[model samples]
Target: MYSLLGVRKKQIAKMLFYENMTMGLIALVLGIAIGSLFSTLSTELLLNLMGIPMDIHFEIPMNAVINTSIVFSVIILYTSLQGFRLIYRFKLIELFRAEKQGEKAPKNSPILAILGLSMVILGYYFAYNFIDYVEKINFLMLALLILISTVGGTYILFHFFTVFLLRHMRNNKNSFYNGMNVISTSQLLYRIKGNATSLATISTLAAVTICSIGISVSLYSNIEDMTKGVYPYSYTHTVIDANKEAQVDATLEKHKSKHQISHDYLLKTLEVKGTAHENTIKINKTELNENTTITVISQSTFKDFAKEFNYNNVKLNKEETVALTSELSIKIKKQFGDLQESNNTKVTMSDGQNLYTYKIKEEFPYPTKNLFSDTFIVSDEQYEHLKTTSKEEITRIINVENESDSKSLTADLKTIIDNKEMPLYDYYTPYQQGIEGSGMMIFVGAFLGLVFLLAMDQSFILNNYPRQTKINLITQSYIKSELQIKK
Candidate 1:
């Protein structure tokens, strides 16, 4: 029984010692992190006080973290190092002992204490540099969060570092209220005293309840995902005639030279020839300018295209027509076959009430591999056949950036455009045709935020102060029974 008690004491002592060291380190880091956060915030506060207009774009919450850390570590080390000086100055027996028997402050207070506080406040002011997201650092919410978290942290810290440590010091009479009770119990009570107060109880509840964060995140994600499919990767004003292709190419070159574009390119148009299973099916082309279909095409560049998406580089059946992605086949009302499907079609027209028959190879979605059109997959031979519809020009695409610095390049290209004097038809710069990428990013961020907020829903709920009733039981019999179990 004594050994078991000894083991418990040792275990508690070890835990207390371990936590003491950890809390010291967290204290150091927290001082730095919170300080940096406040420091940036201080600048903004000062700005507001001075009536200065400030627009915040970027803030890196790293500065206060570093400064506070150094200060905390130094303070800890200084306390330890100076104790060595007292080691020799104190009594002969005190020099040899492992610990002081009483509850004594490790060092002289006032100056060091004030200095530590000052360092902390100053460092914190500097650390919280700038957070437009958290405008008004002195706001009630920030104060409440810090205050409540500090209380909660202090309670847990007391439980781990003070109460646990006091188990070993139970025999120390001067510390344990003349041996009647434990100092750890008193310390624990002191740490959590504020948490029990009427006003602080609300904050305490908010600090512990965690679920409001998840809902906000989910809401944002759903809203974003709903609208993210509108913007395709990139598009340029394209003309299809072979003669107009040169004209459009010349006009594009002028813009390219003006814009200092290094890699201007074009997409190949494949001639796709095939009919639907039913000769009655006349595949009418959707209006290019208005069609909202997401085209998934398999082209001669099928390998390169599929590689880009991390999907299989579909192989054609050497002789059979190439097939579409499963997604596209479903959209186009076609046979749901594998990547290679050989189907037969008869392109027959009623000629003045007489039957006119034309055999057509079966065609699927992979022929027109454009971004916002129907998904089309076509082999090289199939593409050649499909090009008959695109008899005019291949699609010209440009990868370039138009910036303020490249005036000479812009002017040189303008002169070339004047020389060609080609009719300035519809044209779009790369800047005008970028994808709906930011929308997707925003949606994802909102989704994660909603999830986090919902996860913290309880916290938000707890912010609404609850009226809690207190019950005091004064039954001596029941109280004594509980106290006996405690003893």
Candidate 2:
């Protein structure tokens, strides 16, 4: 269509639009049918592997289909009009001479080559070194810097350095004088100089696409493992009242007796406050907001948790305490070089009268649920003092025997909880957390990956079109001249 637009402008526009739209409609129909079929098959296969039973119903969303068709049709019409406008802008003589006049060879620069190499190395250094501090800095800005430097470096290397080296090779008498070598080298150098930016763009796109897909796949594949690290328990419930705690326990035991279920449950009583004051241990100094949560659990409870999870057990005295924080907190501490074998920090409670100093014996990955931000394990005497001084909350963490039984047990427990109106909180199971966290990440990553891959494909075709056409014309002209000489 673009090729013929110069000769029969209006006729070509009309014919091409009609033919393209017709083909597009046919493709849309077939695409929807095949896509729907495959989607249903894939869903069934996934469900079967997950041991889920469901009715298979083949359904296509009409809204999506209509929206897609409309979008494609508009794109096709706009592109066709743009092509016509481009053709009309060119004079007949210029169109004929376009193949005859090639782009001038570009000059090579050693400075640009050196600068490009330095930028690439510096970009990689920042990417590797500052990745852990992403939360502290502007992540988007850092990412853009990396991308621009790497891509600009690639272009400079291809355009200037590569040409410089190849020209030196061409200057060699023995290699240059070899049959066909001179012609091939000159042509290759010219092509590289002209198409350097396009090649660099394509290379960058391919790298980005592969990296995005690889990270997304890795996140998806390791979702269960990651979830296990963050959420060791299948269900975590907070009980405010002692009566409710006993009732919930009895209910769980009754259900366990009815069904073959293995359970390891922990009940801990602790005093929690939303804000920590100036004298707090200050475990997370990087946090901009001064508001830190204080949770004081008994030393015995801490020991029980450590024993259950196979963590190193530590004893706390009335004068000293231990702290347990989230994975992110540990990372932040490590980044600041604050993470040692042990660290002692002073903590002040909400009550001005009671000031206690504590040593952080160890840090463990804990749930980031709103209930508790940071936990301090104190001796029984300190716990009793805190309990009498401040309002104490009871928390229960339960671990199921098998991951497979978690969903069913969670459902049963939720049903039981919903029947009564009690001030209780329940944390999501690992499977649910995986779906909500990793599942959304994979979806967004895959979508962006697909868009980038498609863009790269279109760019490669568009950028190479003129060069391919020029090469074809030259080959055809050479063949025609040989035939004429023979005749």
lDDT of 1 by residue, 1-487 (tens): 3223554434444454555557678777675656556666655654443334576433655564566567777776665444434433455555445333434322223443344344434433433432331355655665555444445444344333333444435446666655325533444333332332433344334433322334333433443222222211222334344675565456546656555454344554432332324445554333122222222233556566445434555554544334343233434333222222334443322212232233333443332222333334545554453344433234444334543233344344334332333321112222112212333333444445555556456654563323111111323455577789999
TM-score of each: 0.29, 0.74
Best by lDDT: 2
The total of clashing pairs for model 2 equals 0
- Top candidate by TM-score: 2
lDDT per model vs. reference: 0.41, 0.64
* Cα TM-score of candidate 1: 0.29
Cα error, candidate 1, residue 467 (Å): 7.2
lDDT value, residue 436 of candidate 2: 48
The weakest ten consecutive residues by lDDT in model 1 span: 423-432
Task: Candidate 1: list runs displaced more than 4 Å.
Answer: 1-233, 240-263, 267-319, 323-369, 374-393, 400-481, 484-487
Off by over 4 Å in 2: 1-33, 41-56, 82-94, 132-141, 172-181, 241-266, 272-293, 304-310, 316-318, 326-328, 335-344, 350-352, 364-373, 415-433, 440-487
What is model 1's C-alpha RMSD?
21.9
